[model samples]
Target: MKVLVLGGDGYCGWPTSLHLSDAGHEVVIVDNCVRRQIDHELATQSLTPITDMKQRVKAWQEVSGQTIAVEFGDLLDWEFISDVVRRHQPDAIVHFAEQRAAPYSMIDRRHAVYTQHNNVVGNLNVLFAIQEFVPECHLVKLGTMGEYGQPNIDIEEGYIEIEHNGRKDVLPYPKQPGSWYHLSKVHDSHNIAFACRIWGMRATDLNQGVVYGTVTPQTERDPRLINRFDYEEVFGTVLNRFCIQAAIGHPLTVYGKGGQIRGFLDIRDTVRCIELAVENPAEFGEFRVFNQFTEEFSVNQLAEMVVEAAGKLGFEARIDNIPNPRVEKEEHYYNAKRTKLLDLGLQPHYLGDSLLDSLLNIALEYRDRIDPDVVMPSVDWREGRAKQRVHKAPAQPSASL
Candidate 1:
């Protein structure tokens, strides 16, 4: 299949592009390098170094001898995006191109607006680009689990049947986004669904959970091919951050009661899910939504898991309870339905100690690069900078603020 991958430089996008290219597909990736710019803005580098775009393509070519095309342009621009669709006429387009960080979205008013404008406008541009050219092509968008928040109901994939009084109707699931970034995702879903219904477009909204791990089977084979791993407070996911913390002998920063439960997918499974979505395209005028997660655990549970994983490798690790920076339920009930992907033959690479160990071993290689100050939560979700309150723990150095 011919494939076009947007946001190909992103955390998940880079690996997905390689995976598809390796699987005998003609793949073309597009990125604006916002991620690199963000790293520049924050002065935080990825925990695991990634090859520059040119070098990555060169390495992939050497290994597979298959050319993965790349076009560096702002997909948010209608002309640039539509021209690609017309030129490539790809069978499928994977949309992992959005403002993905929750905390980064909440950093300030300017950051919040950037999240809203960039996410929504870029998504709208993609929809229009598809409608204009390659209307038969499939669009697999990477939505987030945070769009549902911690609702007190079994979170369906993307729709729910609510029977209030005698009226029974099935509707898109209620959106209770917790942060500005999540809100943008909700808006994207609305716009995508509308375009799918009105203009007859194929779209799949994969409500993905927090992804973890740095090394996949393909990545483990070549150090140069290791997927992007960011451990700073801004770009890092919870488990990735924990791995860095444990490797550097820093106490795991547990916010509030550390009971915030969320679904999780291994980096390998994330790519697998994307492959399945692309292989089985959604029908025109049908917006398919799948909860793309295989496991569920709380923040504390993940911290404990990381600690144990690192301990097996002879690393001393500990957790430090700290005040939660984000305005969210530290403790909540979270039961989400995620059978759609499994029904599509998504055999999950569940988070095992072996996998966690592999992820940590990669982190251990860059232990010297682990900035102790960058591991803790910095971008609090609240309106003000409430996360910077200095409180020492046991007369010792506190976790990063």
Candidate 2:
């Protein structure tokens, strides 16, 4: 299969690109390198040193003997995306090109607007590009579990069958997105459903959970091919952040009562889920939704797990309860259905097993790079003031072209 991985230089996108390429699919990466730029703007860097695109793909080719083509462009530009679609005519497109941080989106008005425009408009362009060129191409879009918010019911895959007013209808799950970034994803989901209904397009919306782990089979091949491990307030995920804190002997900062619960999966499972979605394409005129996660854990549970994992390595880790920066329920029912991926042959990797080797040890390995200042809650959900200084990210070096 010829696959085009948009935002293929990003944390999840980079590893997914390599996984597909290694599985013998012809992969072409399309990215503007904005993620790297965002790190520059936040005065933060990946805890693990990541190489540039040239070095990354070059190392992958040498290690796996697979060629993954890369193109420098933005998805918001219709002409650019349309031309690429027409030229490549890929069998599938794994769309991962968008601003993905919730806190960053909630920072200020400008950031909010940028997140929505970049994500919503860019997704629209991808839909139009597919409609124009490859109507048969399967679109594997990355949606977020955050889009569901904390609904007071068991969240179905993407829709629910409800009997309201003596009539039964299956509808897209009600979205209560907590941040602008998640709202953009909800908007994208609606747009894709509309497109599938009207244009006979096929798509699989993977409402993926928070991903953890930094190592995959492809990434372990070389140091330069390593993936990003971000542990800052804006981009760092909860479990990853806890691991970093434990490694640095800092208390795991738990927002509010730390009862907030969400789904999580290892980086290895993420790549496999992508493969499962691609291998079994959604039917034409179908917009399939899969709750792509292996396990669920509360914020407090994750902190405890990290503490125990740290103890095994001769480090004492503690938890600190802080005021919740975001407006959300600290405690709520969060039983979400995630059987689709498992049915598709996904062997789950529990957080307990990977806690030490995959996360804490990696943090320990890079202890020198861990910055304590950016570890705590910085963004305020009530106030729209930007937490981190916003700067124009410098352009990627021309060698990537």
Candidate 3:
């Protein structure tokens, strides 16, 4: 199968591109290299040194004897995306090209607007391009579990059968996005679903959870092919952040009470899940949704896991409960259904002491590169809320599709 991986320079996208190419698929990666630019803007870089795009492709070829094509441009440019789609006419398009940091999105009004414009507009272009150039192309969009935002009721896959009155109808799962970044994803979900219904396009919206780890089978082939490991407060996931903190003797910064439970998956499983979605294409005129995560953990639970793992390595890691930067439920019911991916033969790499050890070892290798300032939270969710108690703002409220 011919596959096009958008945002191929990103943490997940880079590895996924290599994985698919290694599996004998003809792969082409389209990216604007905006992630690297973002690193510059934040004054933070990937914990693992990353190769330039040409070097990365060259390294992959050297390691695996497989060639993956590359296209450099923003997805927001309709002509560029349309040209790529028309030329490649790929069997599947793995869409991961977006501004994906929730904290970054909430930093200021400019960042918030850019997040929406880049993510939402880029997604729209992809859908329309697919609709016009290759209606049969299967779009595997990267949605987020953050779209659900700790719903009180058990979170369904993508839609739920509700009996509100005397009638029964299945509706798109309610989206209570926690930040502007997540809200943009929610918008993409709605737009893609509508496109599928009206234009007979096929798509799979993988409502993915917080992805951890730094290496995959393909990335492990060469140092240059290594995926990005971000431990900064704005871009890093909780588990990865904890591992870095443990490595540097920094306290595991658990926000608020650290009872904020969320789903997580290894980097390996993320690539596998994308493969599964590609091989098992959605039906024409169908917009399928899969909850893509292996396990669930709270912020404190993750910190404790890191602490225990660090103890085995003779490192004293402690947890520090900091005032929450984001307005969210410190404790909430988070029963999200994730059986679809497993049913699709996803053998998950569950978080264990060994896995934690591997992550810590990686962080320790680059301990000198760890900047103490970037790891600490800088963006407050609300103005003046960081120092004083103010009226709590609602979690970015949910919108009905």
Candidate 4:
């Protein structure tokens, strides 16, 4: 199968591209290196350096003997995107292009606007281009678990069947995203669902969660193939932040009472989920939504787990109760049914201490790369705040796109 992997230079995208290509499917990865550019602008680099896009493709070719093509350009450009669809005529298109950091989305007006335009327009263009070029091609889009933000009810996969009075209706799952980034993803889902109905296209929106860990069998420690690891507040995820903090001997800053809970996944599982979606193509005119996650954990539970894991390393993990930067629920009910992916044969990789230890070993290599100043609560989601995070993240992953 021929596949096009968008945002292929990202943390998940790169590994995913390699995973698919290694499976003997012809793959082409398209990325503008916008994340690297944004990180440079923000003066915050990944904990480890990533090679240039061209070099990465070359390395993968040498390593796997796979000729995964490379393209460097923005997906927001309609013509450029359309031309890729016209040229590649791929069997499937994996759309991972978007601004994905919640804090970065809330950083300032500029970042917020970029997140809106880049995510919405990118997904829309992909829909339009695919509709015009390869109507039969399946579009595997990355939506976010944050879209169903701590709802009072149990979240179902994609759609919900409502029995109001005596009437019954099945519709897209309700969304209440906390940040602009997640909101943009919700908008992307809406646009694609609308387009799929109108254009008779195939699209799968994987509502994935905050992903952690960074190793896959395809890679060992090639800096060129090293996944983009963001440790700063702007792009660092909660678990990743906690793990890096412990590695650097910094106190894990738990905002509020630390009872906030959400679904989480390993980066390896993220790649597998994408592959599962690609292998099981959604039918034409179908807006299939799958809740993608291995398991759920509260913020405090994750913090405690990290602290305990640090103790194994002969390190004293301390906690600092910092005031919440973002205005979100300190605690809420989060039970999402994710049997679809499992039905499609998705093998999940749960978070264990061994996994945490493996991640810690990686973080230790770049311990000096961490800027302790950037780990604190620097951004607030509310309007008009003095402590809003200043850095802007490019965009990221089945995700807040």
Q: Please say which candidate is ahead in lDDT: 1 or 3.
A: 3
Alpha carbon deviation, residue 150, candidate 1 (Å): 0.6
Candidate 1 lDDT by residue in tens digits, 133-219: 888989999999999999887899899888999899999999999988999999999999999999989899999999998665666
Residues 18-131, candidate 2, lDDT per residue (tens digit)? 999989899999999999888877888999999999999999989888888998998877889999999999999999999999988887777777888889999999999999
Off-target runs (Cα >4 Å) in candidate 4 are 384-401
Scored against the true structure, residue 362 in model 2 reaches a CA lDDT of 93
lDDT of 4 by residue, 212-329 (tens): 9888887664557777788888788888888899888888888898989889999988989999999999998999999889899998999998888888977878888788988999
Q: Which stretches of candidate 1 lie over 4 Å from their true place?
A: 384-401
Question: What does candidate 1 score on TM?
Answer: 0.94
Model 4: ten consecutive residues of lowest lDDT: 392-401
> How far does residue 30 in candidate 4 sit from its true spot (Å)?
1.0
Candidate 1: clashing pairs of residues? none
Clashes in model 4: which pairs?
379-389
- Residue 135 local lDDT, model 3: 89
If both were scored by TM-score, which would come out higher, candidate 1 or candidate 4?
Answer: 4
Clashing pairs in 3: none
